[model samples]
Target: MSVSIDISGLSHERIHVVPSPLAELGMALHALSEPGHHPGLQGWATAVSTRLDPCLADRLCEADFLWRSTFSDVFAPFAGLPGQSTLPGATLAEELDQLDKLTDEQFVDAALEFTCQSTYSEPDRNLLADPAVQRRALDLAAARGPQQVKFTQRLLDEPPVVRAWLRKLLEDCDEAFFADTWARLSHQLAADARLKTDLLRRKGLAEALKALSGAVSLDESEQLITVDKITTGRTTTGSGGLVLVPTSLGWPHVMVLHRKGWQACITYPISAPGLTAPPTVEQLTRRMAALAHPVRMRLCRHLARGSYTTSELADAHGMTAPEISRHLSVLKKADLITTRRRGRYVQHQLDISVVSRLGSDFIEGVLR
Candidate 1:
């Protein structure tokens, strides 16, 4: 349910938020390969999925080996990839070809080693020699899928199987969907990077990191940071400072990849207008329920012109102040509006972005 990162000794200067086209590509491939599993992506990823290689998609769905650090983390950083900004295929091919030199042993060892370690730390050399650790490694492999289990076994036995298959999957992913995905993300990625850099210069590292996502935060005490996750797992020590990457592809949820001869990174959703995550079922229902009420609709119409106080809204809508306050409470809880206190009076303002996103999601969700 959480990954608590202790940052007591780390300097603020070391925590960074940057963009990486390569990591974005890796996440997109996995997400596009399995869109139905991610509710936030299901609406828009349909069009993108139609362009993907079906066979490659199927293979990735069954291959956990591809996700193990040997592959994803090992290949995550392509320092120049983000700067390419276009020609995703050309850039991807260039990076993959360069990484092709990673020996079958090197890649397989990293992959196999990842399953045994508790964190992103280096692999134990004698892991295979210990029966208990070996069993855990096998159990982890089998949990993925039959094909992945086989891939893991083959990699352990031959190690060379890693070379051709991994490269092929990476390349096919590019040929299928990387270009279109990059085009969708290019402008936002550049803008996000610039904004974070500016924030760092104007405010500080603390401000810059805090601005990255609601899911991530550096505590005021600065000794610890908390990351929300689906299931609870053991906390890992920070080997290196954080590398914050902003992207549109990783919607709804954020992902953490620890540093292993590379930067420890968190690739988060881009804080942009067009690519907001689909609201949760509760959120959708709440907002819908708010609109369904005639009284709330009247309130919304009045607030659309400008912000209003509880008393003002009641005055405009011909309702008791207490009754108007109740309606305003519901609308604010649904995230359709925001309340800002100004001395004695609080102003209720419509969240215009939420209005646009609501319309877009309603249309897309209904049609989908």
Candidate 2:
């Protein structure tokens, strides 16, 4: 279903575009755990598998349908944006303890909502006579039955322990791969945040918001928004504010979620050239090689002064237009410069973030 939201009077300035190491790590774990479903992620699967705890995979639930429900237990979309996520400061145990605060009814209600319930009607004969309580148990079982029966039964038997088990699984799986993956993906995340921040400064919130997705558009005439992959009246699509999150894990995917008391959000995937698989330090090698050419280096300097037309750069540097064109193409490939055609004239401007490494951590030892 399409989501139609009226943002005319809402505060667009409340938008936040940021990255989350934890959420991305969650996606990574999910991807690697179910590699058969994602051929494109085989490279990441290979890299992550080398360090994973074999036993953790068993607990992670191989059934795609079941796993997503289980995943939400640990990484639910709360009302607030990730900036307010408990994951930042809480250890896995502490996070599990937060789950402890959830009443059994609340947990069951959430788990049941995630899956199909058409087939089942009541809990097992032993647990409770209350038809409502019986349905909760049976619904959990039925939801996971097609893909896996045992995992759901585990949830029923040890309702309170489900979160604890998830905590350990996340710990095991994340410990194996998160640091390196984060190191590789953080550059893209930071660059995204910086880019959006700059866009907001230069273009205002409307343009910046629209730039987020091909399927999403803002209709200023009616102050309405039609966003893709989101149904109307869900979470916080058009309530009053939004949070924009960028992640490498989300590169091929976009997710929208809303919860009361939390920032309604949409997360989109982002990509970095030559660094799609991970270890984006290779991007450093690519960028450095791009700057190695004297003409390209000169082009970067001239553009840094301000955006320029190819012919203008050619005359300033005493080069042929064709030669300047070739240099610009190379710099563009390196992401050091960006170009947009203004009428018949192409304008080239420096992408300063790359010059500053997008304010990400330096490759400590990769480039000598």
Candidate 3:
């Protein structure tokens, strides 16, 4: 549920605040591939999709395995590809240049390792050298999905071909849309990094880590910085220490890469300018209307206590399951609630933050 970064005996100098173009590009690609998750960029994503060349789109489709997965270290310079050294590059060209230095064996190894992360629990890079191991890895990849299996096969059988294809795809993406997008966002990204650096200097690591994102927390007593994540792991910040990369497009998702032989890196979403603008009148109206009903208001009060399944809510409220589900749907549409699966039940809970912000959002909407 959390990633604990041990910072015992680590100097402040080891913790860096750097802006990465490749990491931003990786996030952009992810935003492009899964537009629904990034509601803020829906307009931009739609425009980019319309302008994309058919051939380039096909190539992007082929490489969905890389961007679709949350573990996109292949595009990050700090978490360099397997057998490759880490480099904090300022520009995309510099990052790609670092990637270009990878040998055929290293490229294949990196792809294999990335695939293994999505499929197997324990990934042994040493075994990747064995042809039998590669075959088994391919089988595991097959179980994940078609895109993963195809990419893995190409990576293993045609390393050079895949390497060239990947390079070209990145280049084409830059030319198509990412170049302009980065140009517009780079200033904000750099400013965020500078702000983080200043915070680290003035407030110390505890405050600085806490300011990274809502999902991050610091425990001074334990000397650990814990990140709220689905998969849990712990890594000690050794001599390499920690690198914090600020990304604009990586909103709502904080990714931490702490693999062996690399400095632990956390790529977090920056408080993007203009991106987190106040809600519109329509949004405020919808949210207000969602809680205006007597039944829904009572439901919100109950959900504020804890999460409940539709059946549980129905039982508690003395209502049918269908009636509870309809009200829950209205709240969900208004972004007043969130849901998660717990075994066979789908538990729904009030989005307290959204509810709490309604008053300010309504005032801002009316005034604006």
Best by lDDT: 3
The pairs that clash in candidate 1 are 1-231, 1-232
Instruction: Rank candidates, TM-score, best first.
Output: 3, 1, 2
Give all TM-scores, in the order shown: 0.59, 0.57, 0.71
lDDT string for model 1 (231-253, tens) is 23323334455566777766544
Encode model 2's per-residue lDDT on 113-198: one tens digit a residue: 33433111232323322566555556545423433345555555676776565556656655666766777778877888889878
Error of 3 at 7 (Å): 1.9
Tell me, by TM-score, which candidate is best: 3
Model 2 residue 15 distance off true place after TM-score fit, in angstroms: 1.5
What residue runs in model 1 are displaced by over 4 Å at the alpha carbon? 6-15, 53-58, 61-72, 75-90, 93-106, 109-132, 220-222, 230-241, 259-262, 271-368
Which segments of candidate 3 are over 4 A away from where they belong? 81-87, 102-123, 272-368
TM-score pick, better of 1 and 2:
1
Model 2, residue 225: distance off in Å is 3.4
Over the stretch 1-368, how does candidate 3's per-residue lDDT look in tens digits?
Answer: 57777878788877788888888888888888766446677788899999999999988877765765454556664554443235469888888886776666545655654342432234455433677777777765654456677788777777778777887889889999999999999999889888888999999987888889888888888888898764557777665667888888877668887554446788898754233345678988999999999999888866754456787678667899999999999999998898887455587877755665677787788788
Report, for every candidate in turn, its global Cα lDDT versus the true structure: 0.60, 0.56, 0.74
